[model samples]
Target: MQTLQAQIQIPPEFVLISKVEYEELLNNTLDGKFLSLKEVAEHIGCSTAYLKNEILYHPRYKEEIEKWCHFPTSSGDHYRFHAKSLYQFLDRESVKLFLKKKY
Candidate 1:
């Protein structure tokens, strides 16, 4: 086996996430809401691919997903998020309205 060295240069924006930012990412009323990416995708009935593509790419996505899951790296950075944030991302109310309009 060969050893490999690689440096993943994270964007400055992705680096400066503060504690306040993490706390604000959750809905205060949604108690004990932590989830993994697989959990979120399963709950939303979406593929992880869709989460990365549609949801994660939406203008409001970063703020939202960051509130819903974690990507804890070996760099001592805990990027965990809450679960309710996923519901907010789905915007079930808006989808309901849109479907109502369609029908």
Candidate 2:
């Protein structure tokens, strides 16, 4: 058998994160009122794919789904959801039932 040794390299600039700071960073990162698809799924206690399939693509919810998203007409922008709108969509059937349509 042969013995081997390896060397590790560090960049010129590196900042160490403290436990408290790390926790704070995590909290801040996820604390926003608006969320992406992944964040919305996490909030609703479901997998992203499940949410996308079961709710996002459901025919009964099609018009409402489009209404709650952050981007409606932009071809290149990713979809985002306002926390309030998402909650309303789930909690209030009236919102979906009375679709006046949005421009």
Candidate 3:
């Protein structure tokens, strides 16, 4: 399995925050309002196919995402994810802490 480093394009804005502030933002987010798979792909600026196959479906990140956050659509096949949860998962512990400090 490949590391997240190989798949996602983390932005410079994210790189600039202190670890403490980041963690607070991640932990403080509310639990509702999710993003559909398509929305997530768009937010991450990646193709849906790429996100599904390489990031979501891939064995490594798949379990992590499923365990941390995921919701099945009404169809019960595709998954939807709470945007806040997804962000929390993607941002490192340090990043989350940094976000907290800013808020």
Model number with the top lDDT: 2
Stretches of candidate 3 exceeding 4 Å from the true structure: 1-30, 68-77, 93-103
RMSD of each: 18.3, 12.2, 17.1
lDDT of each: 0.60, 0.69, 0.66
In candidate 2, clashing pairs total 0
**Total clashing residue pairs per candidate?**
0, 0, 19
lDDT of 2 by residue, 1-103 (tens): 9998998676769766799998888656635477888787777666776666667776888678787676435776765886766776777764453254221
On lDDT, who's better, 1 or 2? 2
TM-score of each: 0.43, 0.50, 0.51
TM-score of 2: 0.50
Residues 1-103, candidate 1, lDDT per residue (tens digit)?
9999998888877765778877776446566766666776666676776656655555655664555567566886644556565566567544732242310
Q: Over 4 Å off in model 2, which ranges?
A: 1-32, 71-77, 93-103
Q: After superposition, how far is residue 32 of candidate 1 from its true place, in Å?
A: 2.0
Any runs in candidate 1 off by more than 4 Å, and if so which?
1-30, 64-79, 92-103
